[model samples]
Target: MSVSKQADIAPTLRPPPALPADGMVISANFSVGGFSKRWNHCHQLANFLARYASANEDDPERHATLLSTFFNELLEAIYRNHGATGEIKMRFRKKQNHILVEAEVPINEQSAKFYNHAVQLANQPDPMAWYREQLEHDVPDDDAQALGLLELAVVYGSKLSISEPTSGDWLLLAIQFPFTEVEEL
Candidate 1:
């Protein structure tokens, strides 16, 4: 079933399936990472992921920049939405024409619902308008966590999905980025 449809029917929405172990370019477990350093970590990880993913592209710099922007957005969303305690694991793999990112974060059932709601919003016909409305209006704290995914869908054209909760309270999230088109942006 589609991730959105699965989310609608299942109350235990969690993480995506494990990313293939063979293709990982980088992975990190942020269980002990200080919350104060999340901004730095997110940007640094994004830059590294972008650089590695864009190495063979024509305009490496442009592609890396674009990738970094979207990657940081994804990382920031995890930082904002994850539950209080658990390993936030992130893994990246390079595909033929895109980069696939899989993340498993500790999230409660309520947060899972919020994520599903955000995905639904992002899939709407006018996501950009909804994104603009989010920025212009004061949203509740829970809803504010939805903005990054919305921006990724609306502004960057990334594809996102979530898997059913597996093993524990972890929420699996998958994001696919078609980096080849970045140079033209």
Candidate 2:
């Protein structure tokens, strides 16, 4: 007896699952390197800001404004001593509930050793003192200082650690923030 052969149908493929409704918390870390040369210093700072602008996904005008504000504050802090140059480039990655940012600061002849020294200071429990020392010369106004402190707390303060990666010339600033409900914000 010949049995009737029936074709088996294959199941359709399904798309990958989407991320949870909770939006991501983004972080950006930036730094400058090779600032020994007079012109390179300023260029580096400007470059870093430009990189920040480029990486931002939000409105260009808003991003530019944010960068400009940060740049002005940073410039006021270090212009006399470091004289910004080079570029500020940052790398970011998403963790469980937060994002990590790593920013690089160019090291010039005069600032090379200083940069390393700052890294050492960063290892301490309270690095705010070190950060303040770095900007003592600039003497930012009260409003500026308050804003700078707020930014530092919101951005870098959340970091659990800082390290020099084996693969790249970067001072890794790792931060994590919770993905909370809208009302929580």
- Go through the candidates in order and give the C-alpha RMSD of each one to the true structure: 15.7, 11.5
The 10-residue segment with the lowest total lDDT in model 1: 13-22
Q: List model 2 lDDT by residue over 1-185, tens digit each.
A: 86655544555454332433333323333333343335345545544654453343324354444444444434432332232454544444434543334445433444433333433444556666645654676644432433342344444444334455454333333323222211243
Provide the lDDT at 142 for model 2: 35
Residue 71, candidate 1: C-alpha displacement in angstroms: 1.4
Q: Could you give me the TM-score of model 2 versus the true structure? A: 0.34
Best by TM-score: 1
Model 1 per-residue lDDT tens digits across residues 1-185: 54566547756344442433236667767782464355666688789878876665566788888889988888777776777776778888877566788888788777678777777887788888878887999977766878878778877787788886656487788888776665454
TM-score of 1: 0.74
Candidate 2 positional error at 83, Å: 9.4
Per-residue lDDT, model 2, residue 31, is 35
lDDT (0 to 1) per candidate: 0.75, 0.41
